[model samples]
Target: MDLQLKDLKGIGPQMLHILRNNGIWKPYDLLLNIPKSYEDFSITSIEKWHHKETITCLGHITSELKLIRGYKKDRVHFQAKIYNHTIDIIVFGRNYLIKEFKKNDCVLIKGTYDLYKNSIVASTISRQDKQIEIKPHYRIEGIHDLKLTHIMKDLFESQTLPIYENLPKELLDERKLMSRREAFYQLHLPQTFEAIDEAKRRLKYEEAFFMHLNMKKDEKIETRAPKPYDIHQVRALIEKIPYTLTLDQKEAVNDIFRDFKKPFTFERLIQGDVGSGKTMVALLAAYAIVTAKEQVAVMAPTELLARQHYQYFKTYLKDVNIALLTRKTKDKDMMKHMIFSHQYDIVIGTHALIEEDVLFKQLGLVVIDEQHKFGVSTREKLIEKGKHKDVLYLTATPIPRTLAMLTYGYAKISLMKEKPKRREAILTKYITKQTIDDMYSMMHSALIRKEHIFLVVPAITSDKVTDNIETVYQEIIQEFPHAPIFMLHGKLSSDDQDRMMENFITTPGSILLSTTMIEVGIDIPTATLIGIYAAENFGLAQLHQLRGRVGRGNLASFCYLISTKEDVERLDMLVQSDDGFKLAEFDLIERGPGDFIGHLQSGYLDFKYLDILEDEEIFLTAKEDLEKIMNQPDFNSNPKYRYLYKTYTKQT
Candidate 1:
């Protein structure tokens, strides 16, 4: 709607100032607002109302009234009959209400009831019969409950002005969901709490429906015919590995193979936990595709990760002609020329690989590590640079299957549930104050074993005493006087970070202090202990990832969750289970989807009013319904679809 808050009636200069500051420029912006909470201001009987609680009562003021005029003000005493009980009312210094209180006048008295005095300390006496209110509270800084409602009520009353009709009556009827206008109305000015909840649900459903539509990417689509390759060759590569592949990793490899047999372009996601072997799966797939006379582009989100992948590729397949293309790589033109001329079999790099000048010859498979970080558009651009033979995504963050299906609609998924046999499951514990000395003792023992330590703080520097990189570094240096101590965070230069990481990896009995920025894809197999000082500041998935840096080797590992806050459910959940997928679901449900979505897919899923966790059922229903409808041949011409489609286009 073109209806701005400026056009709405009863919004004077003060209201306009508040509205503009809060980003509510238009009528629909108000629709996007969600009430913080609701309060009950309904009229109640004397017996039902509690002491010191503000309640409203509809009662008749008796003819008998006493007025005591003091020097400064006047005190009025009166009797009101409510629910057949005679309750005394004392109105002090509110002389203006005296005129409104007439004999036998049925007035609404709002005040706190006193049980012992058997009277109400009246604040307001109104002749109007006040209806019961389930007050919807919006916490705008300068706007009170009444002022906010006045603006909302005015917008609702302006019926000729418009809000976008997002869904059709047929869809509403099919789902038994409230109409957009009705949902907005009830949500702003609720009739009953049940109706308010229903309104919230339907609004979330509509937003999620639009979100799914936004993420849909089939506008320019084509598939490739599968090129046959020798299965025995890929198997021999697998058998040549020093250790047997985990069952889940083997199955993931097989899933990629099956996708290769298909006639369509391959879009698959290899999901696993922190120590799970997703990279190995990608390596195998890349080898298979490159051996079939096609090049593979293995992309990582960061330069460090890309370099790590290139080193792994070289270590495993020494004969493979792999090129590393990055911003820091020397001779950019030469690298680009080599890549364009197909002089290399496999190319690994950061987003620098997607520059227009860098082209791949017979690019068959695109393997993206931490795929969520690249998003769909960057991924599509990379695929456009290739032959579109197949694409594989690797991620450590695990989404539930239902959520995965709803989110990555077109991409098939294979999960790596098992870590390697040599890697022991990390023993998790909640660090207590009493265990402080024991922790240092364990560190001393780990020092004897030549293992390193990871001290993860919540920040680079902090106002707090100890839970930061700088302070923790100082403390650790004091404890281990001769040991090598290194620090890493985002503020440091990338080259400095690489140097620090090298020192950390090579130096034995070392301690590295860092922030959550280290949670990406750091492989420190010799590190046996990771202690998160402010454990409560991190989520379940993140905690799992930080703990993953250790326990990568055969030696035992421990994750110390240390925090001042006791009995944190998320922290406890971390200690109880090691599975990343279950922790992701728990974090989504308990803490809300904001952090989870923000960490991975930041810009793509910009939801204004929907809480994906709370509205999961509604979202899934919307997903299923929209999926079926969009598959129809004439869905584009449908009125609701067209309306929303136009609105979405305008927004873009």
Candidate 2:
């Protein structure tokens, strides 16, 4: 069972290298490598095949597989007879398997039916007679699902691994759940769709149960008592402001206050779209904590954003002692001393705030802006600087439900749906080569109006960010020669970036061309135009964030998507709605939770079987069961709950 992957037959050096690259080290890992999805490759007759649709058919090779020299690489071209009809077979990247296909050999060919070419673009051609039933599909990049399936076939045929049931037998009987061993195997190789569903249900239950236990893992921590501050002071600061708070903003603030009044630590996420007045809500929350004589640490993802927060706080909370801490802080030691001495009421900075040298005297609240940018452990590290302090996470990117379920499992949630009344929606549109002239004319008018412009390009010459800004700079300069064009990219140093950004901000009618570096917290009120070239290359949340760069000011703004990918689902969703959260939900439905979190979220929720959105009932049941196990002392000895709890702890 613990044998290296090389023990499997037919897995030569190339296959072993591919498997190792994908993190598969041993035969036992095969059982743990659960399939994310299943594709139906059941052999079907050609009569029911649709054009351009994937179809699998049992066929006999009609001609010897011949290797033809392609312009780029050698190609394998063959003909197969299916249902007494001959069809061309084009096999790509599998020329090594040409020896396996003979003129009369029966094979199962699976791929899309190319009606125009009268061929089947072979995604996989299996010579084995065993029909590839509902085939397991791995979400791996280095190898195709069919090849992985074949590898698994060899591993199972060896029959050296002895699987064990992980779940307690009594609980399985009580819940009518499948055995863990059976569930694991069924996930990879199921006989029917119902079997897969049953297997998934069992795995999801265990995953959700463990997740609930992890959610309550912090219950053992000693929490600081809630300190209520006078609302009058906070109200005074709010009153000093020029405009009224929206209803949503008021509700979110009330929610935070309500959490602050609780005996337990307040961990709430104030999720909202860009320009949704979330900063003001966070400001009021910070003010209350400061009034309570507790220090606050506000963390941003980047120095630019940290400086923006520092400036924003200095303007609004003039009386509070606030310090900006970063790598280049003039008096770094002094700031750390002041923070440790409780002289600074509020400290806003980047990762510098979490440095070992930086200590808080009585850190009461941790305010993390753009929470997604930092890893979950990074947030934990910051919060640990003080005793179990209340946490306030601000994210302009809407929380996808899967993330909301996993990361926000135990935290209180407040949604800020409304932007301030003064901010106008940015008019977003997609442009093709034909409509590019109209877009240029529009940019010309915006420049003439004295407004600034932002142009983001996915410029790549050879590699290594070769003139990303310069390549686009040439064309943009030609279009608006009168306006000063500035370039910003990752290659620039911090000082250089600051200088360039300052120049662009101060100089009206100027343009800034760069990458997604300005994706978040770049405030330019006068900048009314943002052009995103190759918009299809970005994710939906990113495009939404880039689009948010505009429409910050009172004036109506425009976002030009310079791509012809109109049929792209994410692009269509972007065009349909200006709501960031809506786009996030759509992305979650399209790409799933893993794509949204990447590898930043690591823990029990580093998910394998979390269909949190679809299995909400299972999660609720797990939560209810968790309360029983936590409260009952007798359950500690009961093998079912006791062993399962042990399993949960072992994972953590």
User: For every model shown, what is its TM-score relative to the native structure?
Assistant: 0.79, 0.72
- Score candidate 2 by TM-score against the native: 0.72
Error of 2 at 536 (Å): 2.1
Highest TM-score against the true fold, candidate: 1
lDDT of 1: 0.80
> What's model 1's lDDT at 5?
74
Q: Which ten residues in a row have the lowest lDDT in candidate 2?
A: 459-468
Give each model's clash number: 0, 0
Model 2, position 410, has a per-residue lDDT of 67
lDDT of each: 0.80, 0.81
lDDT of 2 by residue, 96-122 (tens): 868776899998889989888889988
Candidate 2 local lDDT, residue 439: 78
